[model samples]
Target: MSANARTVHPLGERLGKVLPPLMVLGVVVAVWWAVVVKTESAIFPTPWQVVTGAMELVEDGTLWEHIRASLFRVGAGFGLAVLVGIPLGLWMGWVGAAYRTFNPIFQMLRPISPIAWIPVAILWFGVGEVSPIFLIFISSVFPLIVQTTSGVHTIDRRYLRAAANFGVPRSVLFRQVVIPAVLPEIIVGMRIGIGVAWLVVVAAEMIALRSGLGYLIMDSRNAGNRYDLVIAAMIIIGTIGLMLDGITRLLEKLKTVRWRYVR
Candidate 1:
């Protein structure tokens, strides 16, 4: 084959991967711009207006401040949830009595929307970073626990039997077998938990804090009717959430856990 022909296939493959999404996004933006123009509504911003608004925030350093605050809250809360949830879930999964005792409360609380806890969070933490952090933690922890528990329950019985037959100590069995078996589920839960944490933090920040992307959206609209900035904040929030999920999804690439993610 000619060198040009060889190069064309890989280049075509790359374009095939990228072109469809770009076309869809272009269509959406075109539609959005057309709607704004046809309506002639001053309130709804054009895509360019939103871009300019984002630029303004970027120049003023407000965007970074809000992003930093939001990221810190998510990281802290989600990190804490992972630390507590995994061990608790493992114990509960291993012990039927613990599972029975706590499962009811988990189910009860899990169904309650994280936003519903805002007032209680405010009352308990008194309008500080703690309130939002607490809210994010609450939103994230349950999923981790539930997924981890399910991972443990679904583990192959033969693996455990073999471990026992080999005279593996309880600690070694858990360290070597149980943890490895459940790590995939735990990573999945982490991806879910981080998304929830990102979602809850925005809501919490809107209600409980003076800073963060949620507050930026609310404050921009309420203070100056800045719909462009409101949309910009939303875009930033969504982009960051997607990035966090992507980071956790990378865990699935690990050789030990790749089977869980492979189609």
Candidate 2:
């Protein structure tokens, strides 16, 4: 096949894959429009009105400000979780004794909801930015730890045996073989943790901080001038989440592309 033909073929395939979701999105918007037209409720603004509100907020820089604040918190919290959780999980996964010692404590804390920690966070951090940021970290960290542990434990026993047979050092085997094998899992964990961080950060902001998308939604509700902005903020949040997820998928594809021909 010609170069152009090869490129166009994959492009067409990708477009085909994307079309169904686009169609579903269109149908959802249509249903939303129909509902708004039929009900005319003040609480349920039309999609067009929400779009207009989104535009107005963007033009006035209010939307960006809230988005920036939320992003900052999410970024900080997710980064911390990834840095700490991944290593700890790897250690726990690699060593039986470590896993035995830490797994119980991790299980004990994992079930606690992020919201449940709000009172303690506020008491500890005093309703400052730290409190909400800490809440985000708490919500996101456990999933990463669990996933990372699972990833490490799932490594093929044969690979380790082969490395040991070849006189590869324990440290070398882990760094070169074990780490790479589990990287995909770590990335998956990071993606999930980021999503949870985004969710918890917004809730934390709504409760503890004076600014962010969550705070904007609360403020708009209190003002009662327009509910459309609240919906707009929700759309923005969903879009951001999708974008973050897309990045993770892209990374996965990049890592696995060479392996595509193996099987």
TM-score of candidate 1 to 2 decimals: 0.94
Model 1 bad stretches (over 4 Å): 1-14
lDDT of 2 at 211: 91
Candidate 2, residues 128-156: lDDT per residue as tens digits? 77887888889888989999999999988
Q: How many backbone clashes does candidate 1 have?
A: 0
- Per-model TM-score on C-alpha atoms: 0.94, 0.92
Runs with alpha carbons beyond 4 Å of true place in candidate 2: 1-8, 254-263
- How does candidate 2 fare on TM-score? 0.92
Residues 1-263, candidate 1, lDDT per residue (tens digit)? 88876675878889999899899989999999999999998899999999999999999999999999999999899989999999999999888999999999998999899999999988888999999889989999999999999999999989899989989998998888898889998998998899999999999888778999999999998987999999989988888888898888888899888877788
